[model samples]
Target: MILIRGKWRTASVGFLCTLLLLVFLATPVWSLVSRSGDQIIIGANEVIADDLYVAGRTITINGTVNGDLVAVGRLITINGTVQGDLLAAAQAVVVNGTINDDLRVVSQVTQLGSNARVGDDAVAAGMSFESLAESTVAGDLAFTGWQALLAGNVGRNVTGSMAALELRSNVGGNVNVITGAEGDAPEAYPPFFPQPPVPIPQLRAGLTVADSVQISGNLTYRSPGVATISQQAQIAGGVLREELPEDETAAPAPVTTIAQQLQYFIALVLVGWLLFKFVPNWIQSLAAIASSKPLPSLGWGIVTFLAVGIIAIAIAFVTFVLTALSAITLPVLIFPVLGLGTLANLTLIFGFLLFVMFVPQIVVSLLGGRWLIHKLQPSTSSNRFVSLAIGLLIFVLLTAIPVLGGLLHLITIFLGLGALWIWIRNNRDRAPTEPQLAAV
Candidate 1:
């Protein structure tokens, strides 16, 4: 009995060491580490893969990158391509890129070109976006600045969280704004209308414009400031912002920002060294299951998603091919197939999201037994199906709304990917015991 007890105790220590190593190794690879760029003056034809994180004086981006960017400078210029998220904390941030993610900036002034294309959301927290007709933001547009003059298209929703927010673009989605201290009849900002630009003070945010400020939606400003109507900022949705004081000073520098607080966020480790103390076997079993059936669930999700996307693309391609094949003969079926395919794509998206939300839990529960799910929440895992059901129910509830739901899903994807990666290392310390192997 003493020998058996000693063997089990040794196994427990090894298991804990393995878990600690896993948590440590996984932390660094997945983390979005901040790395400062060396050059100050970025040229026009350069493309970058990693995110440009800078805390220097003046930085200009005239290149393309596949990651997010965070820069703090006096004059920031972006005239190339950024395929991911962008967060600029500076006096000025200029854009002429094909941005594929969200953009958030805290600057005195912001500018966009007529040819700019932002694939996701755009939020300017400091000054304004005053441009001519060449820039494009493909998602929701939110600005909290002294004065905003937008003259392009925001593909989705729009919001103005500022002293004075103005929009003059076509919206592909709804617009929402939370205004500060407007007049007596605090009307909600207008939506889907073309409101002519009004005259306000030349609130210098020190930015440029690409499109004419075509105010399609209603423009809501505070009751007392004189607005300047340089050009018609036509918008397809409403614009709402705070009522600016007639007398304005330089907006105080971003006092508390995300960049400043990220260190504490990334460094504060939650997984202690003793992660395998209570559920050592669960970890061992998870490792085993992960190593074997690791890719099936993840691959299934990705393949399903991509297959659906490809089908949609094929349908569009077929439509064009038919149109080219015979403009007269193909007209009969092109529109019908195109419409049906588009609808099917939409339905598939919702279905895919639902599947991704719950499939991993179900897969793990089935393969690892009630033991694994029970490890995370023992009290509720009496029935394995019940555990899966409850988890899916919560996911469904959270994913029904747009903003909150989308965020929840994105975080879930990250966690799932992390877990799958961890599963790959399951057998590192699990060499067979002599007694167990002999019995097998």
Candidate 2:
């Protein structure tokens, strides 16, 4: 009995120490360094285990990390393997390795290496993507650029918006491409889906590989412009081609979900980078402060996301209702007004979508900032970092309390929204208006 008791005591102590270490790491010190007043640099060679990152500088990963990577920085480059999701922001990003989960990166130029392998989706938001065919990603591939060269393997679909899009690899899913036409803009799609994104339009000059493509699933193209596919592609699924009367044969584009994820990440990076650009010193300070209250900030962030998501969904439902009214209730004689109302509802829905989409970016930036201040300033009432660490420990242990986790989860989203609200309100126009002169 004594022996068992001794073992239990030792284990508890060990666990406590480990917990302490994690909390310590949560600070701005050894783990992630970002401050509102100082510049920090993270040049990691590699990580042996799963990792989560949050920073405010040029974060360059040249080593292996076996965990999720979440970073907000001026620049981030991952030249190593990540066993989980790779989330980052910067002016440029180059990923060359194996990512077990999803890869969400936003930068001006995102390059995937030939040896890169992703278990799930690979989303990239960039102006240009040089995707090596040698890269093996066992999931979907998505992009939002007019310039993408796919020379790799995609397990799922491919979606993109580009001027010059190329594909030279095996894909496991369908492909959805939309871009400006090459010649007179590719042909328009026959009315099939709910509604087309745009009317027939011309390509502004770009190369595309829509021909000779093999798709395992159905293809969906939404472009008003021309896309000239390369002759070396083989689409397994029946090609659902789109064309305008005056356009050339449409070239294919990239996939979807993965690309959407990438866009999400890219937007994060851009918004963060933009913040830093306008206030480098302030950003550095924010990072420094943020580390002091990571748990609190993180908790809040969760709340904001939930709130926004719910609100957005509600807006979408309302829009859908209006659309239904216009489509069904409105008489054919009053089609124009119905159409007008539908458009208005859609516009409102879109605005809400944008709000939900960018909400995280705004919240995180402020969280990062506040955390930075807490760490650097350390409130007199308590060492914010220490208090935060204790609070986190309490929160974790309270899981046995029942319903705590659920409550915490809900509370987190609200906090996030609060921070985001602050961020947006802070950036509200203070500039001299030409004049609040004439109403349109």
Candidate 3:
């Protein structure tokens, strides 16, 4: 087993190296520097000469950014101007400033206040979107959300996928909406009326648009049912409402019950069993590190994780310049830069993947298995498969807890990543040295 594991590890490393070399030869790199910390804020008086990338718990940008702005946080508020594009992801986002170029955002809730203006396209995805009356977009506006309320003006086009929509403003161009089926008109009218008011259209399982809206260009909508065009509504062009295809209608979401949880536990056990079979020593080492020096391991893990990202960004930026130069003049020089950039990028990305996905699984399994063994018998020597199964079951159950579960999940990820890093460093230190050739 030891020999087999060594051979596999060697082969995997070689394959990774070869793969990175190939990527370096084929792909082009771009320049970027990523900055991350907790509660990062750029004051109004501050200015960024080049592109700015930031990740934090709360990000507030009240300064002028000469280049593009990229940010991720729990809460993000941009009150200053961006000379270039802006990309943001957060739990809640409020943009009250101007974006010289495009604006892209993903969040639970997004608001574009009256002071907000986009020089180019505005694209957003969130649970809810609110566009204040004073807000304006110079180019196209596209959004996907559960509810979209646009009380502002769009210069080019307005496109959205929503469950509920309210447009109390003007769309300079076309209006395209995919939503539920609901209308204001009743089924019948009283005899006092000249004629029965048209019954508002209703969809089987679809989307609806409110009756009060003003659009300059054509109106296009697709839903299971059609929309009722209010005579009061002003559409400069024509209206096109298409029935949603039967096959294209969304299906109901599946419910996760106790049975589902049990299945998840079983799946995790199988994966853990495989890990134990192939890399038992590595798993044992990580478990030991996590149990003994948790704090130091966590500190090192955080450092490694952040340092790798910063290094990768630097490498990629340099590689881009070198590659561009090679593309323009000396093509031969591109290879070295490409190879180095590929290695850096892959390391950063793969490390993130481990922290988020693999490390948690491995660490949780190891801890659980060890605990289960201790419980069943005072002996640490027990059936590995049975211990793993018990541990995974307990882990799954704990994860189902409401608030505590989330906190536990985070702790597990941190511990797992830390332990994994320590184990890797230890292995590197213990690697066998190659003998030097005798002097000629």
State which candidate has the highest TM-score.
3
* Residue 23 alpha-carbon offset, candidate 3, angstroms: 15
Candidate 2: give its CA RMSD in angstroms.
Answer: 18.2
RMSD of candidate 1 to true structure, Å: 21.4
Enumerate clash totals for all models, in the order shown: 45, 85, 7
How far residue 433's Cα lies from its native spot in candidate 3, in Å, is 18
Q: lDDT tens string, model 3, 1-440?
A: 00111232234334333322221122113343446668888899998887776778888889988988877677888899999878776777888988898777766678888999989877676556778888988887877545577877889888766555667677888887776555432222123322211121122223333455678898887766666556677889988887765344332111333457778777677666677788666666666676566677667767766777788788789889889988889888788778877887888788687556655655656556554344334434766566666666656654543322455555666667777677677668996322211111
**Cα-based lDDT for every prediction:** 0.48, 0.51, 0.64
lDDT score, candidate 1: 0.48
Per-residue lDDT tens digits for candidate 1, residues 1-440, read 00111232234334333322232122223433233333475566665657555545567677676677756566677777777777666656777666787676655567777777788777664434565466788766766545666667776655554444444566565544433332222122223223222222243232221245444455443323434434444544444444444344223223333233333222211111122345334433443443344345345435545666797778667656765555566567766766676677677677656544443333332223333233334344344334333333333432332233344444344334434344434346564421110000
**Predicted candidate 2 versus true structure: per-residue lDDT over 1-440, tens digit per residue:** 00111232234334333333243325455443222222333345535563655555466666667667665555566666677677665555666667888776665567777777788877666446676767877877777543677778788778765655666667788777655555532233223423221122223344456453566776656555545655566656655656533243232323343354456445555655565457544433333333344455556566656665676667657656766676676645355654665676567567655644443334333443334345544543343233333333333332211122234333433444444443444447553212211111
Which is the winner by lDDT between candidate 2 and candidate 3?
3
TM value for model 3: 0.48
What does candidate 2 score on TM? 0.47
* Stretches > 4 Å off in candidate 2: 1-50, 54-58, 72-75, 183-207, 210-213, 243-365, 372-440
